[model samples]
Target: MNLTITLVFLVLTSTVRSLNILGIFPYHGTSHFLVFRVYLRELANRGHNVTVISHFPEKNPPANYQDISLAGTIEVLKDDMPVEKSYTSIINTALFLTFTGKENCEVMVKNKQVQDLVHSKAKFDVVVVEQFNSDCAFGIAYKLKAPVVGMMSHILMPWHYQRLGIPYNTAYVPFHFLEGGTKPSLYQRVERVLFDVYFRTLYYFVTQRSDQNTLARYFDEIPPLDQLAGEMKFLLVYHNFILTGSRLFPANVIEVGGYHVSKAKPLNGTLKKFVDEAKHGVIYISFGSVISPSSLSHERVKAILEVVSELPQRFIWKWNNKTLLKAQDKLYTDSWLPQVDILGHPNTLAFFSHAGMGGTTEAIHFGVPIVAMPVLGDQPANGAAIEESGLGVQVQIRDLNKENLLAAFRKVLDVKFRERVKQVSKAWHDRPMPPLDTAIYWTEFAARHTNFTFRTAAADVPLYQHFYLDVICVFSIFVVILVGAIRLSLRVCRSKSPGKASEKKQSKKSKRA
Candidate 1:
């Protein structure tokens, strides 16, 4: 295909509507960039021009986005996301969580460097950005003379704002566990509830006080809450596949499960040889970004490998931080594996993963049953979803020993596991287009049509509107106090009535004297 022609085809897609996107991912990581990188690539390939601002250059990005000096790709490294820190870890979550939504939103506006990028404002048709980086992202959007489109890489869809009353970056998704499957533990539910409550309070404060700083700076006067658009205004575009078990999203929200089908290079020969030679199929295991494979108890690690080594199946393990380690001949060790290629192989029957969204999506997409050892975030819930759907089994990291590992592996290799996988995989693949294409189509739709309709709205509605507590409970308490006070005064008056006659007589006597 002629490169120029591809650009025209991609760009002409916007004849009905053209969107110049300010695509921003705060830091570079598998989760942060993978789906978005593909989504942007499609836009550039389709002929729509993309100006992606990221921390680093993506290798072999679709079309020469950065080198496309002519009508090609315009990729820019924003130098914001640090390369070393971008590696996956749970430790980063606390930092990400600590940044108040408002402060984060304000950071982008205040930063001179980020602001300078926005200084040369492009009258973009639309802005696609992550919701997490509300700090700089919305600031970038504010500079654009176009509508903003918010994209979430996580499973939490924006329509959940209306559907479940969850706000952007406020709280985690409520896991609706499967029958006889792992549900959110009591602790998880409480933590979510507490976090939800905190955001709920924070949102109220932000809404109520939004205009104070704006008015103080602009007019030397404090303005009312209603005047604040800085905190209130923005639209959401999310990446969700229905396979994750979500429903009734608003028309305004888009579901682009776009990461599923990438043009990422396939697996190579040394990897393929291990898969092909393993007559009993392969057990591929890797914990995603944050937790180091070295963190695993050496005993647990050896036990898992020892058991798998004994199994009839072949094994390919993805281990990071194994630089000084020696591996048995039956085992394969690498910091990374070409996951898609391995999953595509017929002999690759199962994936032992940390249950990251990216990995889970791939596993389901290829119809490979999973043996999950979920450690953080919504991994537990996701793992539960997989198990509940009858597609796989999830063992807690703490429970991952020789026996459990073998048990989970045996369950996945069973004929039933393969059958269940085919059912879901068919559903996943048979969709009208790849999840990514759907995401693009919906993103385009969201871009062209600015009126984002939500499934239901809980943002504007307060707790009184939701639980009716203030209306019913508070008012009832007020009425009880009022009635009690009135009765107390009446009783006092009655007691004083007897003294009134004597007091009047004494007053008359004093007057006569």
Candidate 2:
């Protein structure tokens, strides 16, 4: 009996070993950070010591969770992001991320709290860093001497393809910022190629170079930023094949797309009564946490308001200034709303969203159809996918008129659209394992197999070698030489032929005469 008890104790202890994990997410975007918070909290819940570095620290803490807050860093993104698609808008966003990313990195490394952690004898078993606009966190993970795991809150960036060996077939895979699904027209394919080249070049020459300069200020021995990125043990991408389309991924690239979405908590207060008692169901309208509704032009706001007034469905608009939209009996406006609970509610009919990845995933999870008005970044592609997948319709912000807005709502509210969305939601939830478990397992997998080789050799190969351009050059030279030799031989044979010789002599004699 004592031996049996001892064996059981051993088994229990072995199954749940506590690990020291560190997560570094320096970007100040709240929506982006929310996607990662779920995994960090779960790590703490699973008896691991998890420390996170970010601006939005938890108000309440669990025993094993801690935060090293970089709360004072300048907010990288604001309401300045344009609400329309244009060449100027694209350039503005690229330049913004490039320069502001450097500023954020500089501020993070210089912080007193961050410096203390860096200088201390901190021993983390594994480090997870957000693989977004900046890669300066990789240097910190190296300083801690821990295996690194990269977590992407949305679709992979343009530059990530070559380094990670993920194929970027421009013919099918639409650029993140463009508005076409997998089956794009010829014009969109051409646009995708140009955008891909532009972003990749900008990231490599400007963004990575700037980040490396910032890293050199603090860590003298850190490798190049791209090299450290290529060294990551695993890449937890917040995308699924159902939405992003089935694409190839390296062994280390794990898709835990919908992990951040949790079971909706019961709504309470005025919000609960508002959603529960809506006679014709509710339309949840939010532009997400980044873009403030106040930044919207008065014309756009008026258009939205006019359309909502016409609809019989009650509106729950997430507006920053509740006074901006005059309160009507049918409309409920708040600065903050329980978005997930509202979407999960049966009374919720359609979602009017900016099509940010987090909100789009939640809408899909709750089987709520979306009326997407994409503004910037990956939203255009995501919005297009929503329309292509039959999950809903997309209304471009450039065309945010009452006519278009109402049409989009009518399309999403159709019975067939809702039923199709339910089917997609069912498929999305039908994963082999829950997304949270998949994330935790891979994160632990990285820690446990620290010595294992997860990066592909393609990461180290030069572009020319990877694509066999040199071999193509050599083959071209051989073909040229072979063609030249055949032409020379034919000329020689014609010169030496009896008929040709007779004809040449006759021509010479006639010229002499």
Candidate 3:
């Protein structure tokens, strides 16, 4: 009887399955790292052993989580592209990613810890990798023989979707960096097409080759980058149709935009007191983890300060500098604050933001209106989307001045703007489950069912065929043949008509004679 009970216990213990997940995100950007960290934490909380290879690791991670830091990689990347200079332009951003991605990949593959993980007998159920800049991480998936899932912390780019055979029509889905509202003009559409073609060609000829060479250095045999990308079981995009226009995505692609946001934590005593004491409400200002506020030109900073001083509302500015610019009665300056909690506060009136998707989504979640001052990458696009949604006003960085800032504040502070954002927030919260729960379900589903069946044939199809150039060629040939036939028949009729006319004239002459 004791032996039978022991056997039953063993069977029950064996039936409780747990998974091993490996996340590879070697990017030095804090925003990118934070997005991956949220998902990794959730997996750990759900009883999975999660190991992340990243440049920035959490200070105190949960029990089942481990972080393998590639912090040295950031030093090498900083030398290649200085952090002080803003990479605002699309070309500059792309070039920066191209150079830094190659360097980071080399650093990651050669790192002692990562090397051990690769060469050892350790196995992972699923491998999650950042798909934006570096493709070299795919080597880890290949080495571990695990199903791969690519995670994007921003909206899907045209090139990214194309790899999975998803349609990325330039007409509707503008290029990621194009900074304009929805319903683009003809000129904007043309520019979007040209930019898409240029980037795609550049990636195929240059960036993709660099990635392949890097992967080849570590692996004996590997598939082409496109094939490896298409092999991903799922892609978790940090975007939603509410912000990005609704479009059809492959079954493997999942939207987990606000996975990082959660119930507002209690603020520290100092911040809670400051916010609670504000009489006219408070404004929260932040440019995100990257893009230091001190880097702004003196003129721009002065203009912002002037506007803050003039405002009747109290302000909390997240300026990551040792010294404050200027002390004012109404302004509170700090290196960092709980942005989501501040936005969630009833006393908080509006957000002054750089319009990053993370901050934009949080504001939407908390129903806070915004005055967006976009800096780089997708910030401008996010700002435009916010404005189009009637929740914010966008101020061009170059056009920053006291007048512009004040006008933007007034526009966003309107009660109508607040109402609009509240409606959006309600819609966001109306989902069947929380974003984190949905993300976990899809992630585990991918691990259980390594799906390659959902991949579209579009990736394998040639560009010419994919765009139906052959159909256009065939139709052109038919039109040409029809036009030629019509011309020949007209010529034949002309010739016969002249002959008949001459014969009739001769007959008339003979009869008269």
Candidate 4:
């Protein structure tokens, strides 16, 4: 009996700490870095070792983890991904090619950096990758000898998993089409259609080499590309209860909620001073790190400053560099704002932002209403979430003029706006688990179920599945194509029918001969 108890205790201890993870995030964004911080820290808190590879060195490495800070300096996390090789152009080309499905992720698998990292993996026992970069995940994870887990932040790519025909609870996975405003325009709709076709062909192209390499890495023969879905170990998506209802999910896909988190800290005095004096309450404007204030147009900058200047609410702009010094009179302009801290202040009523995932998550964390003026990509989706959930309002870039800015500010303060945000805030806070703890729990969950496959409808699907389900009208197209081909062939055959015309043609041929 004592032996049995001792054996069970050892198994539990081994299961939890058995994970030796190497996290790969070549992304040069703070938002991506912070979202995973709580979870990794939680894992570190559990006495598990963790490692990070980012654009910058992690100033505070996890407590128990080792950081193989390969990207030069800890500050490189704040730096840009090296794109000087006309890399951006290659990426754009890849994106364009991938829009239809030309996948080059395998090249990443075989890349020098990828190979070096895989070769360097001596003590590491598990691999964790951010799904934000499909290339990085496919490359490194394909080569790693350890169990690999992928973390998907946005609904955009997680749905790609769904598209592959993996069974997943759709209610939980973030859907861009949750609301009408987010629905694609005619051009966007057309682009998406062609993009899928292109991407399918592109995936075949990009992964052709790496897929072979991945197979060889495991000492296995290469299988059909379509079978790639079944091979992945596990996938975790950042989602909460409101986001996920009772939905079917693949054996591998898990919802590890609260990926969006702020490094815990109290507000400093300078940040606090600005927040308290904003009599009309404060409008926190931030665009994260990559969008330098120096890059925007003077006219647009002037308009933004002027409009926020007009607002009765005290404006606290988080600018990388000052565009308009005029706000020095009533507003507080700071080159660096402790964004999460400022959002938590009592005087803050609304956030004027580009709706970055980090900023949005902070807003959600504090339950602050948002005036989301999305710039591009997932920012729009994040902004739409605020509106969709009735937590805040979304303003477009075209409408950032003074009048529109005032209107948006006023709308956020309206009784309805506050009420709605309060409701969402309550919902977010009322969760059975806080995001940090939830993240911690799921981190261990991944450690527990390391053998599951993280597939959604996407990995299990084919072109035929899409046609039968998403494109029901294509059946008519098949009929039309068949009928047209048959009709045209019959017409051609009839044209040379064995009647007088054929006999005349034969006689003419004989005369010529």
Top candidate (lDDT): 2
Kindly list the per-residue Cα lDDT of model 3 for residues 1-513, writing each as its tens digit.
646655664464355468899999977777876677777887887688999999877788998899898975565221122222243466777776677777778888878899889889589888889977778788778878998888988876657877877777656664676765566778877877776776676666677788788767776687887778878877888877676657678777888888888678767786787888889899998888777788787888889888888988989988777575543568887887888899989999999998888899888888888888876667766877878766678887867899999998987788876788788778776665567766777667777777445566666788999888999999999999999999999988887897878998999999999
Per-residue error at 410 for model 2, in Å?
Answer: 1.3
| Candidates' C-alpha lDDT | 0.58, 0.85, 0.78, 0.59
Global Cα lDDT for candidate 2: 0.85
TM-score of each: 0.72, 0.91, 0.87, 0.72
Candidate achieving higher lDDT, 3 or 4: 3
- Model 2 poorest 10 in a row by lDDT: 5-14
The per-candidate count of clashes, in order, stands at 18, 0, 0, 46
TM-score of candidate 1 on Cα atoms, chains taken together: 0.72
Candidate 4 lDDT over residue span 85-168, tens digit each: 132433354464343121233333444655566677555555677665344354455445556666756553432444445442
lDDT of 2 at 449: 86
Residues 1-513, candidate 2: write the lDDT tens digits.
646655664465469679999999988887888899888998898889999999878999898999998875675454455566787888777777777677778878887877788779499999999988888899899888899999988888888887788878877875788877788888888888887888777888987888888878776787888888888999999888777777789888999998999888899998888778889999999998877888888899899989888999999888888667655678888888899999989999999999999999999999999999988888988897788777788898889999999998998899988999999989888876678878888888888888987887767788899789999999999999999999999999999999999999999999999
TM-score of 2: 0.91
RMSD each, Å: 8.8, 4.4, 6.1, 9.6
What is the Cα-based lDDT of residue 379 in candidate 4?
59
Query: What is the Cα-based lDDT of residue 302 in candidate 4?
Result: 80
lDDT of 4: 0.59
